[model samples]
Target: MVWAIRGATTVSNNDADEILTETQNLLKEMAQKNGLAEDDIISIIFTVTKDLDAAFPAIAARNIGWTSTALMCMNEIDVPGSLKKCIRIMMHVNSDKDKKDIKHVYLNGAKVLRPDLT
Candidate 1:
């Protein structure tokens, strides 16, 4: 079976360290919650709000030893009144777990983006 786990987090600032650290933290939490290993991950797509330009979230994955997993980074659509300084992720993985059992994570300011999930 295949599953797509969703997650989002926000950085307090646009600093490179802040962005990278927050992204790594979010990814680790998602993996831990879902019982995921790097091998189980097929790919990850990350999107950042227009205001965040300090770093690429994919680099966080690589820093965490996700060298073999396919990764891409993009800009989130700029919508009026949308969340800012947010990094959203969609991780595709090979999993045997039921869809309903999968966990989605939202942290920091991004928690407001998905109240039901957080």
Candidate 2:
């Protein structure tokens, strides 16, 4: 079966290093929580808030040896008064676990985006 794991995190700043670091942390947590391996991942789609443009979140996955996994980056639709410096990911993976067993992670200021899941 295929599952789409959701995760999000916020960077303290708009700097490239901050974005990469936070994204890596979010990915690591998601993978650990879901028992995911690079081979199990089908793809990952990342979206960043309008305020973030220093780097692409997908680079964090590549830096962690997920080079074979398909990845894409996009901008989230700007909403007035929304959280800033946020990076969200939807990772598709092949898993035997039921959907209800999947864990969705939200960290930093992005936690507000999915308080129920967090």
Candidate 3:
């Protein structure tokens, strides 16, 4: 079955290094939590708030050896009062795990986006 895993994390600033580091961390956590292998991943879509335009979150995945993965990045809707410097990811994967057993990850200031999941 195909399952989707969600994750989000915040960067301290709009620096490329900061964005890359935080996104890499979030991806690692999501993979670890879901017991996901690169071959299991179908695609990854990343969205970043307007404040975080320093880099593309997909680059972080590539830096971590996800060269062949289908990855894309876009700007998140600029909602009023929404969290800033946040990078969010939705990863689709082929997994046999039950839906209820899937784990979603939210880190740093992005935890507020899904308090119950966090």
Candidate 4:
């Protein structure tokens, strides 16, 4: 079976190190919580708010040795009241777990994006 896991986190500022670190942390948490292995990952799509342009969140995946995994990054739509400096990820992976058992991660300021999950 295949499933999609969602996660999001915010950087303190538009700094490359901060973006990379926070994104890496979020990705690690998502994988850890879901018991995901790199071989099972299909693809990962990362979206950052317009305010976060210091670096591409995909680099964080690469830094963690996800060299062969499909990864992409883009900017989120500039909605008037949306969160700023936020990075969101949608990861598709092969999993045997039931949908309801999947764990979605929300960290930092992005926790507000999903009150129930946080």
Candidate 5:
């Protein structure tokens, strides 16, 4: 089976330190929650709100031992009233487990993305 683990988080600020820490924590949480294996991960896609253009969240993953994982970073569409300074990630993984077993993580201010889940 294949599963997609979706997660969202927000940086404390535009500073590199904040982005790195928040992004790393988010990815780690997602990986842990879903029991993601490094070899099982097909790819990871990340997007940040327009208000945050300073750094790429994927770099945080690489810094935290995701070097072999396929990762991409993008900008979220400019939608009115959307959450600000939010970084979202969608990770695809190949697994033999049932899809319902996977847990998606939504944290910090980005919980607004999926209110019922967080």
Candidate 6:
């Protein structure tokens, strides 16, 4: 079965290092919590708020050695009162795990995105 997992995180800057580090952490946390291998990931879509455009979030995935795993990064709509400096990711994976068993990671100030899961 294919499972879709979602995670959100916030970064204070548009620097490559900050973007890469925070994104890497979020992805690692999600994979670890769900016991996902690189092969398990079908695709990943990353989005950053308009306030951030220093780097592509997908570069973080490659920095973490997610070779052959599909990745795309784009800008998120800048809605009023919405979270800023945030990068969100939706990862589709092939897994036998149940929805209830999946762990969706919302880190940093982005925890507010999914307070129920946090």
lDDT of 3 by residue, 54-78 (tens): 8888999999999889999999999
In the predicted model 5, the residue pairs found to clash are none
Q: Give the alpha carbon lDDT tens digit for every residue of 2-86 in model 5.
A: 8898999987778777887899998889888877768889899999988887788889988888789899999999899888899
Greater lDDT among 2 and 4 belongs to 4
Clashing pairs in 4: none
**Prediction RMSDs, each to the true structure:** 0.6, 0.7, 0.6, 0.6, 1.0, 0.7
Error of 6 at 69 (Å): 0.6
Name the candidate, 4 or 6, with the larger TM-score value.
4
- Between prediction 1 and prediction 5, the one with superior lDDT is 1
Candidate 4 vs. true structure, TM-score: 0.98
What number of clashing residue pairs does each candidate have, in the order they appear? 0, 0, 0, 0, 0, 0
Specify the poorest-scoring 10-residue window by lDDT in model 3.
48-57
Estimate the overall C-alpha local distance difference test score of candidate 3.
0.94
Per-candidate TM-scores read 0.98, 0.97, 0.98, 0.98, 0.94, 0.97
**Model 6 bad stretches (over 4 Å):** none
Cα lDDT of model 6 by residue, 1-118, tens digit: 8988999999988788998899999999999999999999999999999988888989988988999999998889888999999999999999888888989999999999989999
**What is the per-residue lDDT of model 1 for residues 24-86, given as tens digits with 9 covering 90 to 100?**
999999999999999999999999999999899999999998999999999999999998899
Best by lDDT: 1
Model 6: how far is 44 from its true place, Å?
0.2
Q: How does model 4 fare in lDDT?
A: 0.95
Instruction: Evaluate model 6: give its lDDT.
Output: 0.93
lDDT of 4 by residue, 13-36 (tens): 899999999999999999999998
